[model samples]
Target: MEPGTVRPGGRTARVRAAVLEAAGDVLAEQGFAHLDLAEVARRAEVGKTTLYRRWGTVTALVTDLLEDMAEQSVPRTETGALLGDLTANARLVRRTLTDARQGPLFKAVIAAATCDERTAAALRRFYEVRIEEWEPCARQAVERGEIPAGTDTREVIRAVSAPLYYRFLLDGGLLDDEAAVRAAGAACAAAKAGAFTTDTARPRSSDR
Candidate 1:
């Protein structure tokens, strides 16, 4: 377990939950620049000493918070078809990015990662976990012959969410249902067209 992370059980669970909640709230509302440890402790009603002992620093607290978020994240949707599954995944990403609290929270974290190495690493790990959870959908598609063999499942999953993230982080476009559908459709089309086929699907070095 990382620093500031603990097995949640009974009182320890409650304390961890409160602390992380406070930290997330702070990040969403005030951004990372204002996420003071003392403030988080006060908001959580946890002792300053306890916060210091457990989290040690704001970066560690944020890291643990992200880990907790990933653990608590919703499981992948199974829709039996590649397009259906990708649509579900895209919609989930859209909802999260447009959520009342989660949107700003993610934006703040992304901004923090731009300048903080530890925060950036934690953010990357968070996405990696999410992508792994969703990658199986593409693999299943291959088995169903909906996509070609050697399709890069990870890339397919990433592509589904990439447009949504770009709009959320750069274009500031609305993440509406139509946008979600469009993103999923485009990725599915590309995958079917062999856009994400791995190099293994091509001729081997010896064959060339």
Candidate 2:
């Protein structure tokens, strides 16, 4: 089955998941430069021909891997307050970024994406989906007057994770629950202060 053609439901989904899991393991073990499609096939116990036929290039494989990661990412939950929702988002992001396997895999994928357009596009799509997933929490906050109207939801979501990523990727700092709480609190304060609010704000429905 093609990398992007597997329908979610039965044996095909399971096979695809197995392949992605195997690929992720390889990626984490040895960076993208060392990723071997044949090794992935062997580890997944799938046909090498299938892997080749589906993901023809390293970029394609990484792209599909990123898509799979995004698909497996946790969805946002409504916890009745903006801080709670953001705290959930922050903790989830922190956990993923600090995870032993996922952290290395993500670093490899991000490095590959920087040089490969297909990988870059896939990375963008992955972030887009995540941002959209969290946008509703920001919108709900606006509806409840917990945040300023016309706040940029996507930016707010990005802010919540930016510091965590920065520390993990750049400073090599520990990503703990305290860091998650700090991130959420900072993002919440920024949102309330209109840091994420739009300059070209139009009247919100609640204002009408």
Candidate 3:
């Protein structure tokens, strides 16, 4: 336990916060291939040994960052109506993906996940946590009879976001308030139609 390398008490948390912030900056600016732990240590003003001991590799650092992001995500908006709640979820996704800082950071992580197995798992877990966070809104809708009794709550939540993500990362389409509302409306309509009903899921035809 070297004095400078080993943080005491509250400094451990502070060191993590600083290191994560520096790592995010590197990812947002140049993506993962360019993420050097030494550079991150310099930028974070943390000791290089400490950085190495704590995170070891860029992948580990990014995984921890994703975990923190999932833990700190905004709480679900409870509107008491399926459409209203879904619309809120849609708008929130649009807003986050459009943020100057978050947009690039997310794009970087997504690209990294495409080729890196560990990153892919971390990214998957991040979305799973987020979807679960907002899953309750759809469950409430089910209880209210706004949607079918067997509606897949998490799927309904994912439906509200899938389009916005496509526009942001694939189609390069506009993600405005109108688009959010429309997306939410379509998902809400589909939910009411049993599109996401667990018991009513369509059995797959074997051939592709």
Per-model TM-score on C-alpha atoms: 0.95, 0.91, 0.90
Minimal lDDT window, size 10, model 1: 199-208
What would the per-residue lDDT of candidate 3 be over residues 9-101, giving only the tens digit for each residue? 687888888888888899888888898999999999989998788777788888888887887888889987989899999988888888888
- Which stretches in model 1 have alpha-carbon errors above 4 Å? 203-208
lDDT of 2 by residue, 1-208 (tens): 5456455668767877888899999999998888998999999999998888777766777777788788788989899999999999999998898789999988988888778788789989988989899989999999999987889988898999999988987887888999999999999999998889887774556877
Q: Once model 3 is optimally superposed onto the true structure by TM-score, how far is the C-alpha of residue 40 displaced, in angstroms?
A: 1.1
Which regions of candidate 3 are displaced past 4 Å? 1-9, 199-208
Q: Candidate 1 at residue 87, lDDT?
A: 96
Question: What 10-residue stretch in candidate 3 is worst by lDDT?
Answer: 1-10
Model 2 misplacement above 4 A: 1-9, 202-208
Number of the top-ranking candidate, with TM-score as the measure: 1
lDDT of 3 at 87: 91
Model 1 TM-score, all chains together: 0.95
Highest lDDT among the candidates is held by which one? 1
